[model samples]
Target: MSLANLSRIARAEGDPKVLQTGRSSLPTADRVARSLGWFSIALGLTELFAPGAIARTLGLDGRKGLVRAYGAREIGAGVVSLSTERSLGLWSRVAGDALDLATLAPALGRDNPKRRAAALAFTLVAGVALIDVVAAGSATAVHARAPNRRRNYRDRSGFPQGVAAARGAAAALRAHDDLATARRLPAGSEAKAPAVG
Candidate 1:
């Protein structure tokens, strides 16, 4: 089945009243994740640049351990940034990826000209990413309130049809109840006849 249909089913079954909430919950979560991911990158970079000093200060192997840990962090940050779906989330991802690139830059400058140049290039690209994500978040926000966001898509697959049917069933039930309530009501609200014995 199409992804849209699956989403509809999951939402309807999960929460029938899902449409009631507003869209004010996107920014904070993405920001927090971004901050943590960047911090991971910063720490990784520190370890890379002064693995021995850092390790000795903290009581661990400095160079090899630092490289391994920081490399792992960089890769992990890249994955998280890539996977996040929200535009704000994407920004966080960008920030994280940039942070990793910055960490790589100093290591490149240590000795090997090739590695140094590569790190510098990555740092530049990562800076661009920061700008990209900020714009993406704003773009998504504008897109959300464009007044016609829902009119673009027509082929809703099978799930929307199923939801329509379920809505039909529910509306029919409500109408029946309304009619029953009307029949059983007194004509005047002030006074009612005694129940028939």
Candidate 2:
């Protein structure tokens, strides 16, 4: 099956909202990116509201402004992700995740009371970054492909749609062949005389 079909089936099975609303479907990777987008928004809200606390937790003594700046970046990424095409938004999130890791990396080695907490946060952020990379890659690939062609149930161009259609097409083709053969024979000759029962 095409990636689009697989994503549709997966979403239909997993998301109750899809069933209830009967809304248009999105690809699986796009769904993943949307989830990440929500996550970014939540995380940004936390950081923007509690920058001082987050800075302390990460072993930063007076970097509340930096934390808030990063929070703004997260919020921007989240907004872009939610509003834009999957590939671009997802890749932007990946970039934001990279920036987050870069900002947090120094705390891992610092001599501070929250060193362990910083380490744990670093690990969690790294794991999330991995997910962002994966979702970004999948979205990139899905977006790179051509749009899907809808299946035509009543396809009629002499191509088989089902067993019945196949049989009907084949019969029509055979009759056409018979007529062509008769037209090519001598006027007095019966084309099927040799094959008569």
Candidate 3:
């Protein structure tokens, strides 16, 4: 449900539907995703540096679930950031940052298995955090120069270019027909001219 998580997933697992369409994802969308990614990573890092900080920010009890979730998020972000197709480093950073924060959370107080605070977890979190940081930074850089992903026009409402062109051509034909009729008209046949004009 989290944007950071989703971005991570997308980077890891290709969304065939998105790719098949051959349209670029919007820059605004990229920006949002990238921002979320950074936020997640930063949250993790903040918790890591000072577990008390996370508790202070989210109330003391809120820090409990962060440990496991941090691991999940960092791993997720790393996968996403590593993705060759997307390489959404920014989103990865958020995920990694979240890991850093989570690992740091349990360290704030007396360690317990319930906290399940492990050095390995912290290390993994740290590794991913590094990756995410780089990724997130790269994403920011890309965003600055990132080109808008253009989508092909969908003609679902009956206004496809070909259709419109045909309609225009028909109208032109009709106008020509009217001009031919006028040319064919005899001067005395002005009486037969339609009054609609």
Candidate 4:
């Protein structure tokens, strides 16, 4: 079935039907940031569940705990990126990239057999860091309000004639209803009947 038809499965009776769909209005930076967020979560789950493998590959044999901690951090950043705070999340990923680079630096030494792997990991992270920086900046620019701008709504009102006039008209209608009810009741029955206003 088509996506529109599939969407109808969860809708209740009387709910508005989807006639069509179109492209998302999300900015390019935001779209990239969202993809990065999912990437972060996936990487985090891997690191969290297999920290030993990551540490060994990076020549950090005894630092499985630290790798696991980084995994958790990735997951948190990913969640924030996918949320309304996309810029914040992208910036966080940039910071995490710095940490990853620092952690991998020692593994690039000649003594470590996995130095080649660590170097490759560092290069990959640096590239991702560049992307994160660009996405963060773009997203921030796209969502920011104009400087020194202020909204003015003093001239607008729901009632065309003004609030006081609307209130007066409502009061008059209530009074007319009360008078008509009184006339329809038997004399001295006003106290027995419920109030109209």
Residue range 1-197, candidate 2, lDDT tens digits: 55555568557565643224345578888788889889989999999999999998788879999889888888888887787576676778778778888877888775677889888888898899899889889978877855697667575655437666655332322333476775665543544344332
Candidate that beats the other on lDDT, 1 or 4, i.e. the better one: 4
- Hey, what RMSD does candidate 4 come out at? 6.4
RMSD of 1: 14.9
lDDT of 1 by residue, 76-179 (tens): 65345434644544555566566656655555554543564555556665765666566556546643666755674556645655765654433323332356
Residues 92-191 of candidate 4: C-alpha lDDT, one tens digit per residue: 9999999999989989999999999999999999999999999999999999999998999998888999988876443323333566764565545544
Displacement of residue 51 (Cα, Å) in model 2 is: 0.3
Best by lDDT: 4
* Model 2 TM: 0.61
Instruction: After superposing candidate 1 on the true structure, give the runs of residues whose Cα lies further than 4 Å from its correct spot.
Output: 1-85, 113-117, 120-131, 143-197
Q: Please tell me which model should have the higher TM-score, number 1 or number 3.
A: 1
- In angstroms, give how far residue 129 of model 1 lies from its true place: 1.2
Top TM-score model:
4
TM-scores of all candidate predictions against the true structure: 0.31, 0.61, 0.30, 0.76
Sort by TM-score, best first.
4, 2, 1, 3
- RMSD of candidate 2 to true structure, Å: 14.4
Worst 10 residues of 1 by lDDT: 188-197
Q: For each predicted model, how many residue pairs clash, with residues at least 3 apart or on different chains?
A: 2, 0, 17, 0
